[model samples]
Target: MRGIDVEVAPGEVFGFLGPNGAGKSSTMRMIACVSPRSEGTLQVLGMDPGVDGPRIRARIGVVPQQDNLDAELTVRQNLEIYGRYFGLSRAHVRAKAVELLEFAQLTERADDAVEPLSGGMKRRLTIARALVNDPELLLLDEPTTGLDPQARHLLWERLYRLKREGVTQIITTHYMDEAEQLCDRLVVMDGGVIVAEGSPAGLIERYSTREVLELRFTPESAPTAADLAHLAERVEQLPDRLLLYAADGEHVHREVARAGHRPLTALVRRSSLEDVFLRLTGRSLAE
Candidate 1:
């Protein structure tokens, strides 16, 4: 990782946005205290990770990119066993498991084996297990990667509750909409370095126009960036479409018509985090 520096305030939902090999996972590992940094200072929850790794880890909850729940164990047993590893008494672990099961909306499946549960159920259980110690800080790595929309919203609601209760969270995600919805403040990283940092709206306003006019045409008739440059503030040519960035998308669309440009389909939408991401990270796919 490069010389990355960031500060996440208490009770805030901070996000890390990047493509593959952007050092997000490496940074997360260091913050979780499972991997040591080679240089520079690192602090998590007011303690230096190098000196207080265990203490820091004890106070933070981590929901990894993938669920690692023991498939052989029942849903309730997964939570109870994890809490036991924290040295909690059996009675306390039992009570905590019950509360967490309800929080995860998995109480009905508490007695069922992990292997039989749906992907969403397993994800919820993993999150509940992470919270067994009632951590002050939570680190989530792609908390809702593969779940259906319904399950994604459910997880978002649960996270919102945690935020309301003043539990600080740091999340790393590839989904632009998810980051925009959950993050109060975020930083965009590329090639192991932070390139941009701000709230979702702030970044969009800074990096993009107020609206976007998307125009699609047949492959052979597609307009180049130079062809539509005067119709909008800027134009981005994609393999399938042309994006006209402007403060007024409808105005640009009308201008395009007046300029004798006909597209197969035209869509005018508000600028979003995805627009800002592609602008900052480039439209090319990251390996």
Candidate 2:
């Protein structure tokens, strides 16, 4: 994490994006005061983590990359126990547990043992637990890494609501769609360094065209970027297909046919965070 500089504003949903082992976790841990940085200035909530670790931690909630729930405890008890660890009154903790159960939509399963719950349910419970203290900042690491589509959307909605409540959040995700859906501002990290930073729309506008035209051709008949250079602003060639970046996708698609090149499959869609990442790192976000 050398030469990395980051500044997160209050009441903003800021994100760190990178592929596996790109040092996103290392940087996040430093900010969380769980790991010490060899050298850098890190201030969380206007306090230096190096000197005020305990105070900083008390005001923040963390939802880690994986769930670390007490499997033997009931859903409600899990929240209650964690709140007590923060020295909350037993009565307050118990009432907070009920509120969190409803917030997580787990009121019916309040008494269920943690081990039997599904992955998405466990993730939500973990988040609700983090909010037990009513911290000012929330740190979520890959919060939707392994959920089904419906579960992912539900989690996203909860996060959106949290945003409305003005809980400052810092999230780290490898998923471009997740970053786009949740981040107000984000930075792309590669090999422990920031390569790009901006709001999603701002980054896309700076790094990519408004739309992308995808053309998949047979292995033997794949056309070169040089052959279609005049049709779009830029061309990115992948193993299986070619990407044509242009403001007017329909016009570019039509130009492809007019140029006497026919692909096996063609798709035209708006540019995404994936495109911005690919442009910056010369690699797919999936890679």
Candidate 3:
């Protein structure tokens, strides 16, 4: 991955999106002050990370891609122990632990051992633990990677609540929907550089047509990309299907039918961040 430029305003949710090893994690680590940058200027909260690492880190909350909860401790104890590292008074830590547990919807599990919690629960606890110090900025890396749909949505809701309460956030995720849901602005990273930067809608508007028509055919019945060249602004050929990018999906659908190409299946949908990434990178965002 390459070093990239980004500026996130206060109280905003900024998303960093890319495939595995696209440098998203590298960027996040730099921002989190866990890994030193090899070159270029890096600033968090108007302070230089190199000189003020501890001070900058004290004001930031981090939820890593993987949960690192202490399995030997109960939920509340984990938070209590983490707070001690930050030098919070014992009384303050106790109060904060209870408050955070309630905020994370884990009050009932406060006494339960972390080893017995589900993945989502443990993730929530990790997030809660990060908040013990009342950070001004939160960093979440691939926050929803392995969760079920319901769990993902629940986490999204929790994050949205934080955003509403004026907590600035920087997130790195591979899920297009996660970017669309949580990001006020985002930069699409590929090969260690930013390929595109804008709000979800802005990127979609700039990189893709207004709509997309997905056509699938039998393995033996596929049409050449050239066969649909004039049907839309752009035509992307894939092994199993063809994506026609056009202003009007239905219009392109009809054009494909009139061309004597019978597709096995067809669907029309609005453009999305996934379309923008694919258009710019020439590769699926996740793959």
Best-performing candidate as measured by TM-score: 1
Candidate 2: minimum summed lDDT over ten consecutive residues — where?
A: 278-287
User: Per-residue lDDT for 1-287 in model 2, tens only?
Assistant: 87778888888999999888788888888889899877879999999999999899988999999899999899999999999989999999999999999999999999999998999999999999999999889999999999999989999999999999999999999899999999999999988899999999999999999999999999888889989988899998888999999999999999899888889999999999989987887674444
Better of 1 and 2 by TM-score: 1
The digit string of per-residue lDDT tens for model 3 on 165-238 reads: 89999999989999999999999988899999999999999999899999999878799889899889999898
lDDT score for residue 231 of model 2: 88
Worst 10 residues of 3 by lDDT: 278-287
TM-score of 3: 0.96
Residue 218 deviation, candidate 2, in Å?
A: 2.8
What TM-score fits each model? Answer: 0.98, 0.97, 0.96
- State the lDDT of candidate 1 residue by residue for 51-120, as single tens digits: 9998998899999998999988999999999998888899999999999999999999999999989999
Candidate number of the best lDDT: 1
Off by over 4 Å in 2: 284-287
Candidate 1, clashing residue pairs? none
Q: Show model 3 residue runs off by greater than 4 Å.
A: 1-3, 284-287
